[model samples]
Target: MVNSKIQAAEENLIHVYNRFPIALEYGDGMYLYDTEGKEYLDFAAGFAVCGLGYNNKELNEALKAQIDKICHISNLYYHVNCGEAAKELNRISGMDRVFFTNSGSEANEGALKAARRYAYTKKTGRFEFIAMEHSFHGRSFGAVSVTGHEAYREPFEPVLPGVRFAEFNNLDSVKALVNEKTCAIILEPLQGEGGIHPAKQEFMEGIRKICDENGILMICDEVQCGMGRTGSMFAWQDFGVKPDILTMAKAIGNGIPVGAFAMTQEVADFSLKPGDHGATYGGNPLSCAAVKKVIEIFEREDIVGHVKKTAPYLEKRLEEVAGEFEFVTGRRGKGFMQGLVFSRPVSEINLKTIEEGLLVIQAQGNVIRFLPPLIAEEKHIDEMIEKLRRALRKLQ
Candidate 1:
């Protein structure tokens, strides 16, 4: 029987998520408990947002202490948590200044504004942006303009014009799209929602050269593949290419709502002046404290190194599972952000997996995305593999 309280929530709430039809009451490490107390292995990790895992002791303590102190304060004033968080971000990202926001889309919005403002200052007649086909930035109006998926853009037509699309991992496509009218070339180093495709090294280097030649800014959207998700603090570090502007969220504040955009000192000073842009709860103490602790734990626990060690094991196990199924096409992605592409449509498989108590995310192009927490242990990996095997066997 469905809980009356949960049913009330379903009735009252807007249907944005179209969730798994189960009410998650709590989670610990890589497992979640439904309202009925059924435990499920969570490979989705709140859609890749929870990096450190749920109910982490360090994170809980930090948040509790901050709650006792202060939850929020406007960005108009100086805040200690904001300063500390910014310092930690700068250290981690190698960027100069950070603009805080509440979500990944907002961070992308800020980056877009910065690109335009930079062009405006130069009077370069460069108002257009070049994005990639099958790329997902965010849902905000500015972000949607650069997002390449037609379905997401169709309903919200006439979204800020002059946005162009190029083929992802295809340097020639980007070169052809970029010209005098381009203000920036924005893309993810690893495409997340577009079925976990990692940008080739040559492709990234080619784009860097093209952007430099065209005098256009390069922005890397690391919202999903960043923050130790790809066994590194930022995915660009893996490619050895640095963007003029970087946008990130997801694992930044762990489960807390926080996002950030960073740029070089020159770009930040010239493009993003004070009073140019701001968010109400952007740099609130609560979010900042959470981010600070998240970074601290990532470093102290060597979470990235742990992911590097564990990812290969998970990948090998997934390969073995795929070997058993004729319909399994291939595995893609890096570190913990892996995807299993199937020969057949995966919607039925996803539903069956959910029924068997495993949580996975469905991505475009018949792929099942796996984004487990960075702190997931060997036992968690084994559990996920066993559940997936059971689900696949039943499908056969």
Candidate 2:
């Protein structure tokens, strides 16, 4: 039965999201069942946030246990779980320090502030940041300022000044935009919302070189591409390029709200003095406990290895389906974060796929994004592909 509450929602609530006309009740594994008891294969994975899949036992248990112990504690006092989570994050990321936030945008905000502060310390008048075109940072003022999408930033005109845009996957464009006045250059190793465009190897190396030569801090926003989503623990590691600072969120806590920014000791030293930045709910005990368990599960299950082994199979299946559809232009991206570009708009296809009992997301440039949970089995992949095939046939 469709809930009357949902219908009421459409009438009363703000229509921020033109959401699919279905109310999700619960989910298990890679499947979400709607209020009407209809099952749908979940390939979007809650916009790439639910890494362990729906209603994961371990993650649920961790949350339940934490709920009994403690839920929220301000950063005014030392918290055990938050401290431990920071240590673990530093260990995993090979960074000296970690500052936690509640979302990816907040983490990026911290990174931007830190970059500006670092520049201030060096007596460098550089305050500008060079971001890639089509990049999708969060909706916060600082994040949207650096984001490349005009649609998202159009309404909120008069954003922060000194943000310059460069072309994604184009190193020369980045080189041309970055100068001594540039304090930082931020990019996603794999562009997510903009489209699943992986940074070319040469481009990755080139950005690092530019940062090195210009003394600019290289900030990699791994909010969507990190946390074992891209076969590797960090996507930057895959290209053998390191950043002075890195921001992460999404799957970090396995759906628990937690985000972090890490930086080298030197970079963290400048601009981020005591009381420089803080979050009210950041680094809370409950979120940190979830993050700890998430990391443990990743290590014990070898989730990264699983993604590497299975991604090619998933990609092959997607490619095969693409070949059958005349609308499919090409496929791009890395590991589990793949995109199928189509000659036509994908919004109709996305809606139709939902009706066919599958859930996926449409990216910019008319691409259908596939970000299944890293723990998903081959059976789930096959199910998703089958649904996609059915949707394609209907579209044709």
Candidate 3:
């Protein structure tokens, strides 16, 4: 089965993902079982998407129940689950409205469109947005255009115009770029693809202040950092700042492909009209069921409290690894969304760790990112740390 699956993917699938030499078939809790029945510890959480872990009993039952009831219903009509999901998200985020999409990229695209429309409503020709350097939004044309990595943007040139790049955590730099044409500024609370760099408290406060003083819209793309992956329900919650608009995906559905962009009451009131923007597959019943269930589980299980309690143990273990390894240079991020920086690229370390029966992920700046499920306790943390240590020892 493993060989057949690998061969099938190699023959038919697009060669975009840098897939490891493993053919995984199933997962339970924080462990994944390959086609060969080899169990491996999971720390990647499917790139921070599987927050509830795999085959969660409640989630499975919910999905089964939803399947028996209904799955896909077009956006032209309303579904009960979709409305409930939107209401729950709004309650959690303090946002007034929700627009769902198939993936994080589409959610961010929606937010950008709303921003442009909001600006046009306020004043004509307000199209520009300020994005930060080393930030990753998504891969769609508009999203990639605002993304800071030149490599991702160079080949896909002529991306949306009027977008400018600014140094992250530098309020002065952001202030310098603001003008009448500027409509919004989008950033991640903790940059996931940019090596898990969490925003400093002062920086987040400054961004909020700058946006308020300038009458500019604020966007926080929490695709990789939301859904209680951090200690708070959302990364922005940790800093006591709120955004005019917010985009979320990944763990929102705990592996189900669901995404959403939200806006404040005033922004929703003035932004895109009925005919301006829409998604055909957005907010379908099946996906909405998953989203609603994930949110409910988080609240009922106190997943945020678990993350807040167990993250320090993971952090201390990572710090100890850094102290022991000469090549280890720095650590960044907070709560469960953490990364360890090395003086050299961590591709080998990542591969070696996978071979050592652990799954991890990589980010920019030689970062080995650790995003375990919110259910991870001290035992999982200790096991992950020991496996990581074994991998690092191989480098020596």
Q: How does each model score on lDDT? A: 0.91, 0.91, 0.91
- Alpha-carbon RMSD, each predicted model: 1.1, 1.2, 1.2
Q: Which stretches of model 1 miss by more than 4 angstroms?
A: 1-3
Q: Which residue pairs overlap in candidate 2's backbone?
A: none
My TM-score estimates for the predictions, one after another, are: 0.98, 0.98, 0.98
Model 2 lDDT per residue over 1-396, tens place:
657869888889898897878898999988899888999989998888888887878888988999999899767789899889999888877788899999999999999999999999889999999999999889999999999999998899999999999999888888888777999999999999998999889999999999999899999999999989899999988899989999999899878889999999989777688778989899999999999999998889999999999999999998898798889989998998999999998999988899899999999999999999898888888988888999888989
Give lDDT: candidate 3, residue 159: 85
Q: Write the per-residue lDDT of candidate 3 for residues 55-108, one digit (tens) a residue.
A: 999999999999999888767787889899999999987788999998999999
TM-score of 2: 0.98
Q: How accurate is candidate 2 locally (lDDT)?
A: 0.91
Please give, for residues 186-255, the per-residue lDDT of candidate 1 as tens digits. 9999998988899999999988998888899999999999999998889999889999999999899988
